[model samples]
Target: GRKGDEFAYSHVVARAFDTDHHQLRISSARLHDALQGAVAAMSEPMVSHDAVAFYLLSEEVSRHVKVVQSGQGADEVFAGYHWYPPLAGVDGDDAGATLDAYAGAFFDRAHGGVCDLLAPEWRLDHDASRALVAEHLSRPGAGTAVDRALRLDTQVMLVDDPVKRVDNMTMAWGLEARVPFLDHELVELAAACPPELKLASGGKGVLKEAARRIIPAEVIDRPKGYFPVPALSHLQGAELDLVADALHDPAAKERGLFAAGAVEALLRAPNDALTPLGGNTCWQLGLLELWLQAQGVR
Candidate 1:
């Protein structure tokens, strides 16, 4: 956690505004104990480390305030992801090329790679992930490759992923979280702006420029910060055993969601096998079984 700039920038912004600011730090032991509760609150199998941090943070925030404003949709609405910049100037008329570009950047693994990890019965007859993205990209309202990418992310992925994560975690703690960036009027205006504008200054240039008027320049110019749980990155000691136990459990064996060879390979070198997006393969597989078991599903 000491390696992260999140705390530093947060302190700078907090002091600049001169609002009543408090800090909450969590230890590995506390995070481990809170893991199941975080997973349970999500009520779905998402492997992002952000969920646990939000869940734990909401627990603290609820004690201070009943409602909080979260900067969740700003990235999607303003095109703040790495993929957005690359999609600029691509031929939107070429459906195949557009889909290839978007999927190449967004999907963690190709459908073929995904099928390799599943047992035969669990494998799908088609590339469902590709099909979904293709349909979203082909929609009429978006004019360019970047627009299509932003549309898909803001309308589809953002709603189901990060937005849901914030909602579930805050609601679990009896706190209400409001997202102003997602307001229909603001989103419509942002959507109408040229894709190149949103893609400038690395990404979300418009938002960053507007922020400069209010916040310090150092924060506006700093590299983006991500929430990382170092303990989970390369599993060791009790953390490794926690994942090993879940995959080895009789329930996991009965479910047969994953092929034995793939599971065994990941277990043998848990830290080495990573997805295209660099997610830990061992944790991804273990998380599914862990979630199913938590939900009491057969």
Candidate 2:
């Protein structure tokens, strides 16, 4: 929590379990450590910036704790993400059509925001990546448009983002993490919850009710949030060079994941004024380089 958390830090920290941290700064060393773990964890070069940040935090907590429990599936199972609200408005035939459209956008940022930064000739087979997601969208399930949205997130977001981040980050430090929300019975219970209860106006209606008694109302009712690395601010000077070098590397050139002209434009940007897409791409390129280095590819 940086500044304006709804609940006092101490109470939120207690209830958040191992995922909570009382820090403000994101040092370069933590970023480097996270990239190392990302490379080792991945069989290839796919990156999750969200996981990179969390994995770094998990590394720190692993020093004191040998095992930790998380609320990973709870959000997906209980409909806690902000993305759920958009899907709740439609129903019946149009709802299915909307979900079909939404499925294409589930990873829209990583695809459109970051991947689109690359030149068409240089971009990876993003369609192949999207096809993989489309498979999950087509998974056997029964539920409303919102319920389908929840299932879609469970299939993609929960596993790819949080769970992977925690698992890799904790394991990098020889720690183990468990997710109680993923328990078989608990998952069934969450699945059985009504959409209106799980995904009200904003989202997480039922979870708020459950949290009301167990945790402070302020914490329960507060807007959702998560920690992220300060990559946008970190993208300048020598730090940018590390990323620029990676983009210009002979091996990276061979892979052709980015356009050389686009790389130079990124390097030439003045100060930290790049757009959200630009900042995210810089971080992605840097992490990919770090991962490649760990793989002995660059």
Candidate 3:
């Protein structure tokens, strides 16, 4: 009933009839019907870009109600963006200039075009910045630069990036989420693909070529778009207050998920505070508090 009358009726009927019927029967039916209607409304190539349709088809065969997949790694692997191609093409001064351009673009986006947003106290001092940047941009445990890039990405961004988001969202609905693309085999295969093959001729060239073999060429060729979510934009008022509350809550503090001083420093710091304490620590603290509360861990 919380989602309204239609959802309540569907819930009751689903519960009264059969549990599987509610989840698979009603939900799948509605999803399929809506997708069909959407496809019909669009043009030939547009209909082919139906990732939802492909997902639903997989779901039907596997009887899995929920799935989460990330499409970012391939893009990263194959220099898919406008920036990466130019960076890769340059050498000597041109390469240095390209890196500067990339850094400028990142600063503009991350700092809202105001360099002053990064507080002087928290800003990376020259030596520290150089070391940090070197460490971050260097490829560890790989022979080639490309290999190192893949290893670093797989270790940090691909593996760790989506864990909390996927877990929290799926668990909220009491649904099991499967990530087929994250299968060990797929990860290894992606890592092993040659950089020249992966990044050939600009964009995620290899992935696009592979997709053409199975998917319609039109779908494969289309410019990629990010999956849309309004969560960050909508976090305000009660939501922002809830975050503040959780950070300062005595129970949360007692749980010792994060050092109290660290949490305080993050809150007290400016929005663009470059302090090491100001990154994912707040969310990590909040999730840890929720986990403690759920498990009665005190």
Q: Which segments of model 2 are wrong by more than 4 Å?
A: 1-8, 11-46, 50-52, 92-96, 100-105, 109-140, 232-234, 270-279
Q: Which candidate's lDDT is highest?
A: 1
Candidate 2, overall lDDT? 0.64
TM-score, one value per model: 0.96, 0.78, 0.46
Please report, as a residue range, the 10-residue window in candidate 3 with the lowest summed lDDT. 40-49
* Candidate 3 residue pairs that clash: none
Clashing pairs in 1: none
Shift of residue 55 alpha carbon in model 1, Å: 0.9
Assess candidate 3 and give its TM-score to the true structure: 0.46
lDDT per model, in order?
0.84, 0.64, 0.44
- Give residue 222's lDDT in candidate 2 (0 to 100): 63
lDDT of 3 by residue, 1-298 (tens): 0110133344654555465542333243454344333322222212112223333333453445554453535555554645444344433233235335445433213332122323344344354433433465553345444454455455654544343344433444344556655567876776677666767655667777876665555445554444321221222344344446765677765655553256566555323333231233333334344445545557
What does the lDDT come to for candidate 1?
0.84
Best first by lDDT, ranked? 1, 2, 3
RMSD of 3: 13.0
Flag the better candidate by TM-score, 2 or 3.
Answer: 2
Candidate 2 C-alpha lDDT tens digits along 132-152: 645654555655667767776
